[model samples]
Structures are given as structure tokens and as C-alpha cells.
Target: MQNNPKIVLLNGYGPISINNELLELYPVTTSHGAIGFPLKSLRAENVTIVTNLINFWSLTKKMKPENMCYLYAYGGLEDEDMEKIKATSIKST
Candidate 1:
């Protein structure tokens, strides 16, 4: 496994792009019920996640600084929670 996989944390609906590459989308699942792990735990490699702000909060709380996050969704996290995450913004053309 790559020690530093490109991890993208998406906010909002639809696809999220970082730098110039569009991340592969992964939907949040509940069909199997709550798993015994954080969402990040499930991803061993680079992954792009399509999730709500709630899940995004949980993920960032324990996220490593090396990971890259793209926030497009609004609400859920507080100012302090936001501090924990090292967020990257989309540049306007």
C-alpha cells in the first residue's frame, strides 16, 4: 500500500476535482449497516469520497495532514473542527 495515497474529501453532491484530475466517486453505503471502522479506515489507497458533511467531519477528525481534502459541501463542522482539517480549495479559471 502506498504510504501517501491521494485522498480527496468531497462535500456537496456530484463529482469533485482536485488540481485537474477528477476523483473517482464512492457513494456512502448503509445497506450492511454501520461497519466497525471509520470511513477512512476502509480506504487503504487513494480514494475520492462522495459523502455528506457529517461523514466528512468524522473522517477529518482523525485525518493525517499528508492527506488532501477538497470541501464543496457546506455546514456540519464547526470552526474548531474545520481547523483540524487541512483543506484545499478549487482555483477559479
Candidate 2:
């Protein structure tokens, strides 16, 4: 048997809704809204949500569910920020 990874991607600007049994990744709206992805639909041992830092902070403020994993990424880094990051060297032991 093999185990695969389940990941949900969100833009962080769209609205998210959570009901009794499901969590909508992106809820539909009247003006330019994205389709929702029900959490219940994914049948996996582990589910990871990938989003920007700002959205991660927002989600934490609302609710921090147990066993839920989140991976935050830098969506848009300025030129200076990119340069700084590029200058930073990593050392592996």
C-alpha cells in the first residue's frame, strides 16, 4: 500500500466558509468569486493547506483546528526582499 499527499491551494483573497460538516476553500460570490472545494470530498490521511502568510495569519485568528496542517508561502516578494533572500546562504550539516 502507498500513501499520497493531499493539498489544497487558496489565493488568500477569496472568502472562505465553514459549515457543520464541510469547509469551503473558496465560496462563490456575485462578483468574481471562485468555486468552493469541500474538505469532506478529499479522502486522505493527511491534508495540507497551502496559502500566503497573510492568509495563514487570518486563518489562525479565526480557528486553529487540531490535526490540520498549513504551509505558508511568500506569494509576492519585492525586489529588495528577493535580493535579500538570494543573498542568504544556507549551510547544511
Candidate 3:
């Protein structure tokens, strides 16, 4: 992995561009009730987002900078998603 933090966007649809910057898209298994896991193990300081709370906690604990792991709300997520982003935007002192 590169020095830059790894960004994993789970369950995202359409394009892989966030804010016009293209990011690597990793496909995860969402079938058979399997929890989403990256193809390989993630190192510390990596970032990830998942819709399931269980996966959120799992990633948060596994990845350094726990705040980088987030819970994504699907459908009608405009406000709720913003709140989650803002909450995790800055790490508290």
C-alpha cells in the first residue's frame, strides 16, 4: 500500500469519482448475507464506510484512527449522510 491512506467506499453505486477525483473501486460481496470485507487486509489509517453497523464496528476496531470507519445510510440519506460525515469529519481532541 502507498503512504496515502487507503479509501474504501462500500456499496457505492454509479461512478467512482468523489469531488471529481477518481478513487479505486473495490467490489465486495453483498450476497449470501456476507459482511463486506476488502479483498485484502487493510493497514492502519485506512478509511472505509459500510451500511451495516456490525461492519462499521468491525472496521473501526480493525483500522487505526477508528473515526475513519463510518456507517452509511442508504436511500433518502441526504441529511443523515451529511450528519455522519460531519460527525466524523474531525477527530476530537
Q: Quantify all predictions' global Cα lDDT against the true fold.
A: 0.33, 0.31, 0.32
TM-score of 2: 0.26
- Angstrom error at residue 74, model 1: 5.9
Positional deviation of 3 in candidate 3, in angstroms? 41
Q: Per-residue lDDT of 1-93 in model 3, one digit per residue for the tens?
A: 543222333432112333334333322222221233322222222234455545644552353322232323333234333333322132211
> Each model's number of backbone clashes?
2, 0, 0
Least lDDT summed over 10 consecutive residues: which range in candidate 2?
Answer: 84-93
What are the per-residue Cα lDDT tens digits for candidate 2 across 1-93?
742222233222222232233333322222222223322222222233433555554554454343332323234323432222211121111
Spell out the clash pairs found in candidate 2: none
**Which stretches of candidate 1 lie above 4 Å from their native place?**
1-47, 72-93
Model 2 misplaced stretches (Cα beyond 4 Å) = 1-45, 75-93
lDDT of 1 by residue, 25-92 (tens): 33322122111211222221223332464555565345443333324223333444333333344221
TM-score of 1: 0.24
Best by lDDT: 1
